[model samples]
Target: MKAAVLYARNDIRVEEKAVPALEPHEILVKVKATGICGSDLPRVLGDAAHHYPIVLGHEFAGVVERIGFGVSKVKVGDRVAGVPLKPCFKCQDCLSGNYAQCKYYSFIGSRVDGSWAEYVAIPEINAIRFDDSIRFEEAAFVEPSAVALHALQHIRFEGGENVAVLGGGNIGLLALQWAKLLGAREVTVFDIDDDRLASASRLGADHTINAKHPDVEEQVKRMTDGKGFPVVLETAGSDVTMRQSFELAASKAKICFIGTPAGDITFSHKQFELMNRKEFTLTGSWMSYSAPFPGREWELTLHFLKQGKLNFKELIFRTFPLDEINEAFDLYRTPGAVKGKLMLLPG
Candidate 1:
């Protein structure tokens, strides 16, 4: 098996390794397609996770090459995508189907070896079979798309309210579409990148704003008739944007933080008191998971893609074979050099 192994920060190498063996109730999947996630950037180029010499990939689609003795949900030659989190099924959170909240959760590509190579072994229960109607790349995307959908589950949408997504990246764009699909009256995406802002518009943002604009807050208020957005998503993951998220949210509104903060954030007492004064419902969304393991997020992502209600190919900016992973990383890390997702095809 060939893999892009991350030996340490700024030290990923493409090398050969033995194929992993499948455990009982597991399936050996011949990876057909995979995509690099935004989270992967920090893990590869900066301090993100606690491990060395890890195979770093999880957003993937594959074909089953072999099934363990007890596996029944899928068979050899079946096309599938996998839920990357391996939970301790005995935990209270796991028992309740909120697997992301499980105390002993180990994520593929982070806490465990992942599908950066020709093969990856996944528990049969984590595999979701998809038919030929969806492309391998699209199937690989279900994981991230599921993240977008799962974030919304933290709040209720009774319609007639606007949605504010504070980033125009892939996840932010997906969140924008979902806000519309889930019944937002208007969707506005904010970003500093012109290209990503344009992509957001093409994908159905009712309005796009450059977050760097001096009048960003004023424009947002005007767009929402001075009430601010009732439903807000902070997907930019920066200290600056995290603070602005509070500013953009309306009184008594629901705000979901989908982006992981890169550093410690300092807030003034006045800023902190707003949560109490406005009675804001602030929810922190982690990696997507729910009851039934992969849950409705994965099912709905595939369903929407199959129905042509969604399309992200425009967001798949580039595809590299396993041999060109180094180049892919170089390109992805270049400042303001990209507008879409980068994919790695397992050979």
Candidate 2:
């Protein structure tokens, strides 16, 4: 198998490696399509610490080629998408249906070798079978879609509520669409890049604001009749945008932090007090839950896609072969080039 292996900071190489052996409860998947996420950028740039000589990718969909002895959920020729987090079901957090919070949780593409290769072996429990109608390229979006769904579940918004999203990237765009689907009366997206803002407009955002504008806060306030947005989702992981999120939120509003800053942030204590005085709720949203049953956010995301309620196909900006993995990362680093999502196909 050929894979893009990360050896050091900005040192990824395409090399041949032995095919991964399947565990008793795991299944082997023939990699079809994988999406590059923002989280992968840190490891690619050598800023974030990660195990060297690792294959990186988690947002993916593929066909099952072989199954472990006990696998029953999927069989050969099945197309599937899955949650990357592998958790011990007996743990307290997992028992309580908070798998993301489980102490024994580890994710593929991060803690272990992942989808950047021709094949990967994942536990049968993590896989979700998709109908033949869903294309592999679109299936690659299931992971991010699940994250957007998780964030939506964490926040409380009323129908016809005004909402603002702070970024125009893949997650932000997905958030905007989900907001609309969930009955937001108006959706606004903010970004410094005009290209992304334009893409946001095409994807259901009622309005797009260039945060680079001098009166960005005032613009948001004016749109909301000076009351500010009832809900604000900060997806632009930057200190500047984080502070701006505080300024643009309405009193008694809810704000969800979906993006992480590259460094620490410092804000005035008075601003912290403002949140309390305004009775605002500030929440941090992580990845989707990995538990079973009714609140299965990942399952709901796939359902939405299957029903044509979530339009992921239009959001794909480009697709590259696995051999061009370095070029894919380079394109991802180039600002304003990717309008939505970029996929890597293992040909």
Candidate 3:
């Protein structure tokens, strides 16, 4: 087996490694297409990884090469996407069907060796079988797509109200589509990058706003006729976007924070008071998981992809072979050097 192992911050290397041994109910997948996630950047370049000498990649799709004892969900030769969350079923949160809140959780690509290799072993329950209509490249997006859907699910949105998505990056774009697909009257996407904004437009965003503009707030107010959006999704995790979420919500709105903050976040009094004044519900969403283990997020993602309702390929910016893993990480060294998704082809 071959893998891109992260020895330390900025020290990832492509090296030979032993193939993972499968346990009962586990499946060995021949890695096909794996997408680099935003969370992976910090682990490879910053001090966010839990351990050294790790193979990092969770968003992936592959073919089942072999199955362990007792595996029944998928058979050998099945095309599948991997679900990365492995929750302690004994935890109180897990017992309550809140898998995402499990006190003890082992995440692939973070807590263990993951899909950034020619072969990886995962639980049979984590192997989601997608329709053959869905390409391996498209199946690679199931993780992030499920993430965006999970954020929306936190609000229990039964749409029709105007929705605002405060980011045009990968997650934000997916959230925008989910908003529209789930029946939002209109969906608006905001970002500082024109390239991202343009993507939003192409993907059916009712409106796109450049947050870098001096009149961003004014434009937002004008578009909503001063009422602001009734549903706001903050997917940027930047201080600016997090604060703007407060400034952009309508009274009695529902707001979900999907993106994880990278540093200390300081909010102004006015921004903090908006929650009280507007009586808007503010919730923070964690990893995408719910009842029945991997849950509806992953299932519905594949459903939509199979139905051709979701845009998967459009979000991809580039792809690299596993041997060129070092060069791929170097692309992230320069801020904004890459846009959309960067896929790794292990085959």
Which candidate achieves the best lDDT against the true structure?
A: 3
Q: Which should have the higher lDDT, number 1 or number 2?
A: 1
Which lDDT tens digits does candidate 3 get at residues 22-80?
99999999999999999998998899999998999999999999999999889999999
Query: Candidate 2 clashing pairs?
Result: none
> How do the predictions measure up, each by TM-score?
0.97, 0.96, 0.98
lDDT of 2 at 182: 91
Q: Candidate 1, which ten residues in sequence have the lowest lDDT sum?
A: 153-162
Q: Which stretches in model 1 have alpha-carbon errors above 4 Å? A: none
- Total clashing residue pairs per candidate? 0, 0, 0
| Candidate with better TM-score, 2 vs 3 | 3
User: Model 3: how large is the Cα RMSD against the reference?
Assistant: 0.9
Which residue pairs show backbone clashes in model 1?
none
lDDT of each: 0.87, 0.85, 0.92
Error of 1 at 52 (Å): 1.6
